[model samples]
Target: MRFARHRTDQGPRLAVLDDEDALIDLDTEPDLPALLAHDGRLRSAGEVALRTRRRVTPWAGADLMAPLDPPTVRDFSTFPEHTAGVVKMLDPDAEIPAEFWEIPAFYFSNPYATVGPHDDVEIPPGCALFDFELEVAAVVGAAGRDLGVEDAADHLAGFVVLNDFSARDVQFHEMRMRLGPAKGKDTATALGAVFVTADELADRRSGPSYDLAMEVRVNGELIGQDRLDNMAWSFAALATYASRGTWIRPGDLLGSGTCQGGCLAELWGRHGRDHLPPLRPGDVVTTSVELLGGTRNRVVPGPPRHEILPWRRP
Candidate 1:
């Protein structure tokens, strides 16, 4: 079943999409996280909502919110093509680190920075090279620790399209210190208007991931495209690795990092820095993944940068 959280006069309400594509209100839970916290609640509630057309709202006019305010957001670089492209861009002769191939590496992102599908994203302070990453995210439905790859799949609740907005200039500068991608990435991350249940995608299963087409556009022009099946690691592998020595709980989000050519950085690497300019105020960016749906965000300006104290030598 397809689920969504949308704004209503009462507040944000959980909803399920009916066969006609209309949203049927699921009043038992306020949001997806609440529903998923209880075992089997999502399926049971979804079934009941579909059976009794309690309150139906047209999907076209509903005001959508991010499916849930995730407790944690872990983004993984599981696509070798994107990883290799970025490595080459940084150093033409540099090879992908052997560790990248052996482990499912990820970085924790600020969950507080999440925005809704149609919301406007602000360009980080002092940022000139703002970019967007097109990817898919898995939402955790169950709690588990140190899970194996096979057991991890059962803990997945659903999938959503994720946009990991970035500030390239700030990112590279921090990485030079071998420390962060912090403020450069924490500014914004947009999620779905639709959260698709894992079972719904059974037919598209290919290898370790669903054979879904993914794409991104800026100002109505297609800039990048790829398939989800291209990942070097599967969602289950990522989840299992994440659970190592930690707890994977309901509402946690795991992002399949930028798909092949899914960001302007990759295009910049392949072509030139000036080939496709960075996002500017009023520029619209739309990222879509098959079945999971998409998000359309407009760029906006942020506060001016404030200087911090300069580093002092001891």
Candidate 2:
């Protein structure tokens, strides 16, 4: 089932997609007992129209927030296409470390920002190239450390779609100075339409992207797409990597970065506008990934201030 959190006059409640993909109210009798007790005010009201088998507010009508009330967000570099293509840019003979062939690698993304589907994205003014990255993210259900691949399946709470919006200009500039993926990759991030829980997805296993297919379309033009099964690292590996010497609590999020050929930067990048154009007003970008879900966003020029660190300046 496609589960989402929404707001109504009554309060915030939980919602799920019916067989028809319309929103349904799960607040009545059976469903609410346990989820409500555990989730607290974090939950949203249910969609009653589904009970009556009628359409009241379309999925588009409600405010769709990020998939989970995430406590932490870790993004893994598991996309082979992105890795290989980027490496080839610096050296044709470049190769990933032998250790990489074994498992996943990751980095932290801001956790405080709330994102929703179809939300208008603000492209920071100075960026020469604003790009879209299509990826998958998983929610943690169980809290644990020193977990193995055999134990990974039970820890995941659900799955959601992710659009790791990037500013290539700032990213490359910072990297050349031998810095980490700071300032450059952390300015902004987007979450989901809904997070389909573990019970909903079938054939779950350890894989880079859950065998899903994803595509990125800008202003009605198909720009990028890829298959999820092509990953270089599995989710279990990511979980293990993140859990190393740290406590992983329930509600942590692990993201599988852009899939193979998932973005234009891997295909015909840099010299072409298709790969390197600065986003402008009226640009609509849609990320569609199978199983997990999809999201649509429009680009707008960012605010006057060039940059603001997430925390206040000293």
Candidate number with greatest lDDT: 1
Residue-level lDDT of model 2, residues 1-314, one tens digit each, is: 56765666656555677665656645532222234335432233333435464333457677665645567888887876577765654556766566556667676777764367767887765765677778888777667687887787566667788887777777777779877566556655777677776666567443544666788888878877777777777676777778877867767888888776556555534234445455567788888877777888888887664555776656
Candidate 1 residue-wise lDDT, 20-130, digit = tens: 778888858666787888999988998998889788889998999998899999999998889877776677776778998899899899999999999999999999999
Candidate 1 ranges beyond 4 A from true positions? 311-313
Candidate no. 1 TM-score: 0.97
- Which numbered prediction scores highest in TM-score against the true structure? 1
lDDT of 2: 0.67
Clashing pairs in 2: 12-43, 12-44, 13-44, 13-45, 14-44, 25-47
Candidate 2's C-alpha runs over 4 A off are 26-57, 90-93, 97-99, 204-209, 268-276, 305-314
